[model samples]
Target chain A: MDKFNVGKHISGKFNEELEAVRNKVLAMGGLVEKQLADALSAIENSDVELAERVLSSDYKINQLELEIDEQCTRIIAKRQPTASDLRLVLAIIKTISDLERIGDEAERLAHVAKASFNKDQEHLLVSLENLGQQVLMMLREVLDAFARMDEEAALQVHQMDTNADRQYEALTRQLMTYMMEDSRSIPKIMDVMWSARSLERIGDRCQNISEYIIYFVRGKDVRHISREAMEDTVRGAKS
Target chain B: MDKFNVGKHISGKFNEELEAVRNKVLAMGGLVEKQLADALSAIENSDVELAERVLSSDYKINQLELEIDEQCTRIIAKRQPTASDLRLVLAIIKTISDLERIGDEAERLAHVAKASFNKDQEHLLVSLENLGQQVLMMLREVLDAFARMDEEAALQVHQMDTNADRQYEALTRQLMTYMMEDSRSIPKIMDVMWSARSLERIGDRCQNISEYIIYFVRGKDVRHISREAMEDTVRGAKS
Candidate 1:
């Protein structure tokens, strides 16, 4: 999408190495996305079996992360690819790290599902599942954006985090009100609040992955920048 | 400390580049450590001014992270460091990312301090500040281990996360009890819970840094490993 071309490398093998590493990252992303979906499913239906599956599946995502990390280090040492190629490698490194952490958050969310909530707390679980679904959608879209290295799509995903945060804040306020109204349910509501917090964090991780995609495509570090500034960087680049 | 001799690189310029990047990371670590200290101080005393300062100081840590990240990327592009040298660069990259997130948690702690707590809620903040100090010590130790790439010390710091987690759980349960006992304090207690969660996360980030130190020295991916396995990796490596 940018000026640098991975396809035109002098060594076709080197191009393959980069492609292979990126593919591994995408594969890891796919597994993590599934884990999030499963975690949300478990939470929604209070499926302890599904939640256990998500927990054990986390080990696989961690394995994929380490495997891909080694491959990236090997490519860097072997190919010594410069410019956008190196940026791509660095972005993959960072993207996988975020993906692994998303898997951790998913595990935590799954734990919330395992907790036996009373009948009165069912509505709180429903609210958490609502937010969980929103975060799941964001994760799916960000992974899609990363797959295409689409700067425009990445920017859109980044902006969507604002809505996710709003949902999370609303849930937190609702949980607090629920606790105040029925103090005996405070312990259960607290667990739901933590789950809501984990969902919010998953949104932030997706936003981080989106930034990495933009960094790879645009050769600019868009992190720590204002939303308007990030938009300008992503939109103003010459294609 | 390991098999690599960074000081004896044939290209003294490359040696300088590597050394310079490592020093920048230490400097950034120093800044983040200070931010954590100030945030804790603000929380203990309810010093809004100091809390604001910690919040502002977060920008500096973020800027330093960006600067150090660019330096690492430039080193890789220019030096093409291989083997241990490349691992050092990678470790530096990953360490700074964790450091930056630690800064974010410190900013979150600062916000907790800025909130006006009721006089009755003071003891909860005291417990939070207790856990805050424990995490602060862990951060300090991890930074020291990272500075030396001391695998032994890193292992020690990594083990400390268990204590931090215990403290966090204890604080969480205590807060829940307080919320149940006095439902009127639910909102304020929830903020304290968030702060305690931040402290626990800071502890995890420190554990990550400790793992990075061991990886830099031992050339192993110790993440997601058992405590015993990580110990074997860190302690069994040849120096």
Candidate 2:
């Protein structure tokens, strides 16, 4: 049996509604993942047109978020979900918020891509692309975890974000050095810095989604808990 | 009859519990407001100790958020609140998320305050402080609106945030000029920029809280709606 189906109801309509909401959330997650990927590629390729497309497409993500929210509210109001079912709806709500924020971060990156920069900072761009790819992967896996209600996969996503943070810090230091070496590069470097920050924030948002998944699956509030403690809690629960 | 008590229940205990949760959220809001103010003062006075205090005290805000969340969950589970009651609890949940994020922005500002900078940059500091004050005022008013369930006050806060954004953009342009004029000032100016960004984010977070208040009171999904449309909706509903 699927972990998400742990609390299956005898009422087929209620189950169908829950599944419908879950599918919508997953669809939103897919759009956000593509948006982030496209935004990063736009930055790497300096494709202003593609960047503009990402920005305009952000409205779709926002619309999906609104739809998902309405669905959750309807579920709560009409179905009156309790216990695990309530947690699932709440998790979906929180997940969509994180996903929408990730979309916002992606839009910020697209704005950076849209800005004109004279010189090509190939090294910095490569690092940023790497970071973006990592976050994108985490987002994909976290959504998968959410689909299956897999706490273990969610924990893996959380761990991956820690590495992404370190990469972001290292990249920031390198960018600061570039700014100091040539003042003329300050504007361009600043854009890169902002894009990097957006990517880092996306990583954090991914961790937020992972936490929500864990909360939904294990019925635990892993937020604000130390990583080690959370790992132990996950392990203890699995055992 | 208090605006918040529009749906007053015959169940005295449920009403008392709801009031208690509301008080907790307000108290948490008060703490967050102080945190933002102290962080700004820390920046203005370059008081590292004060900044450190704000950083350390953020845990309390986070704890309050968790407490309020638990209270909301308990209320939902025990009372099975529907319609306006459900909206109220959901609004509280969303508001605390925004408040906690505001606390986070304050912590980031404090970090900037802790960083050592030689020159006063008095003009920029004053602008940043002015932005902070506006956000703080917005925070205070939004909390008042939440307490009273006032859509009108929330709309006022929403409008103030627009001015805050304009101030932030103007300040950013000024900072960019300063950076271009003196290359060596890049590092210090960047700190100020980050602080300004934090302040702007606080304004956004306040707007989110205001939106939640409006949603709770009006029982309308006002999110993602344009300001003009939202205002028209509010007015149309009122008349």
Candidate 3:
């Protein structure tokens, strides 16, 4: 029996509590996903107002994190859950922390979008937007994996970190070229570079979330392992 | 009694287990602290070997994190500890994660040092070096606070984060000036900027560790609260 099973407990109320906590996590993930999307879209279309909206809504994500964090703590203190149940609570704690960090990155991107960029700086913004969209999609898929607790899907998203890294490298190089070509634009270009860095980090955070899903499913800690090793373990494990 | 108490539990063996787990965390923290010091010193002295050493030692910190994580999980599972003991286990889990990330920032700083830089870029390196030292000190003090589980000390260290942020902002402005003055050094300047960012994050992580200490001693979730309020809560508590 999987630890994430819903409504399968001897105590129906306990099942409902677990299920409610899981739902709250999903709801938080959804809000974070939207913030990233809007930040990326705001940068793409240069919508300062939209970016402002994303910034204002970040507190809700933070609030959810605190609330969910307390709930998990209470659950552990009260349930004194064993084995898989303990793992589930621990994973929730780690996942929410990662999600809260993702929200912080989203806020940083929104700040970049809120910064006024003119026509000359549009190319760098375009490159940032492209890399950001890749991260955003990765985040979306990871959340889906999180929702389904699908280890295979989580593995796929984890591998996508390489693509995001390559894109970030390219963007960094391009931003440097622009800075060298016109030193006057150094400040503005730095803003775009910071946004690119945030996107790459968001990609990493998504990878982390994916790994948490893998751990929750496989009862294995895949962090700091080589890809081949993780893949072998994932494929070898019985679902 | 405080949750971080070393020998207060009824079961002497359980007390020993908790103490062992705590010692492991402190050991891990000490390793991360050394990594940061070596990275900063390597930057200041232009010692490539020292930087390489920091990079190689990072894996040890990661290994400790995994080891400590498993031990904490096992403690929770076997002990089914409630109240303070449970909080101690949970706090250990969270603290190790932050310590692991601090090691990552140290790795980034080492890479920046390993990248060769000429004398002309010395000023930017000096600025980064200065900022790196501030973060290093913060890391050290936070770990000490953690060791003692001293709420007052933790609060003191937490307020020092503002100083680190101010230093980071000044360094960022200085780097921007260097980039604009000579576009030829733009790439090198960008590397320094990334190091500065990493140092800033290390500072934030130190603050997080301090908060965890406060939470353990006070039974309060002090995250996301205003500084004034956190101060009031910390000083207002009966600890």
Candidate 4:
């Protein structure tokens, strides 16, 4: 008749299971991050083989995501985790999804690199490279927070997303100008613009992942709220 | 100690609670559909007041999302529902987030409409109206699928997204052609391009929502997969 005793038994096992799921997600995060780096390098050097490798590796990311998701499903089915544990599983499920999409974006960038390198689009290419670096930095910070459970680090990633978005907008404007001044540049510039848009989206996805961390550890929805409000809420809880 | 008896007692209450959450999500879905319609009308008329109203109403969408998410959280915390019930709650939570973002994109379209109209870019206004109509159609279809739980309807939305993207590409190319012909039209065409991008994004968001329906009712992950694959998978499952 004692609910507390029943809770203790389930909670202990649930935490261990959820932690396992978290570790899998972090591992998937590392794979996606490396994939992004490879994608950039592939684009930078016009490494066709490297680009092909990046494309092939996406399947692995997909398979791993499915596995991790199945594991989370099994955990929820077998063990009725609550509060933080439930949030952790849910967050990981969503985070790996974002991570997998990053892989897709990276593959798209590699595709552009394969097709458009010989074209006269050096400036747009440089812009893409810059955008890629910024997104990678944001993604890395969020993963670090997830791995270490560092709320401050996670919040930093969320803030960086705003800056990334601004950069995308500026680059979009710049690309428009390039295409406007030279009709011949339209096709190449469009390629660069789409790639830039993809990187900005990667930044947004990273921000979504950071939100999941806040939700998991702090149990708050920080999606539409301001960064200052999010930081205050998370920090308030920590203190 | 029979656990089935305990589960039965808990699940009986859990079903009622989950139904309430589902009802809330459906209601919110209806509200978002209305917002999307208002946003399109704002874009067509370049009505700043309507834009402001759309932005203001975003708060209500946000509030509804938070309420539904909190209800799901409470159910999750209390009953610790598993399997189908857990999937339903999780899906509802995610769908609400996507719907909230759809509203944000609509608001964005309205804001840009305000800016473009303020600049007196009458040349590009017709295209904005057309793009708004295209996006509104997509939004209507997505909402219909979600309300009806129709997988085929959802699958159609994804296909429609590709067409929207192609139209956006064509719009961008047309804008580039206009800008290149006369630098005087550059500012006005830029506004057109943003509206086109926003409309394209609305279609993308609708695709995202349709995918959520597929994931929730069908228990499949269709995020990175191709549109054809998604539709085929859904069709195959239903058959």
Q: What is the DockQ score, from 0 to 1, of model 3?
A: 0.82
lDDT of each: 0.89, 0.86, 0.89, 0.77
Give lDDT tens digits, candidate 3, residues A132-167: 888989999999998888889999999999999999
Give all TM-scores, in the order shown. 0.97, 0.96, 0.97, 0.86
Which is superior by lDDT, 1 or 2?
A: 1
Q: For model 4, how does the per-residue alpha-carbon lDDT over A21-130 read when each residue is reduced to its tens digit?
A: 77788788888998899888887887888888888888889888888978987887787667666776777877887788888898888787776555566666877777
lDDT of 2 by residue, A21-118 (tens): 88999899999999998998998898999999999999999999889888898888888887888889988988898899999999999998888765
Can you list each candidate's DockQ?
A: 0.89, 0.54, 0.82, 0.40
Query: Which of the predicted structures, 1 or 2, would earn the higher TM-score when compared with the native?
Result: 1
Backbone clash tally for model 4?
0
Writing each residue's lDDT as its tens digit, candidate 1 over A1-239 gives: 33347678999898778778778888999999999999888888989999999988899999999999999999999989789989989999999999999999999989989999878778889988668888998999999999889989999989999999999989899889998999888888888888898899999999999999999888999999999899889887653
Give candidates' CA RMSD values in order.
1.6, 1.8, 1.6, 5.0
Positional deviation of A176 in candidate 4, in angstroms?
3.7
How much is the lDDT of residue B228 in candidate 3? 89
TM-score of chain A as modeled in candidate 2: 0.95
Q: Is the docking of candidate 4 incorrect, acceptable, medium or high quality?
A: acceptable
Fnat values, one per model, are 0.86, 0.27, 0.76, 0.38
Per-residue error at B178 for model 3, in Å?
A: 0.7
Superposition error at A110 for model 1 (Å):
1.0
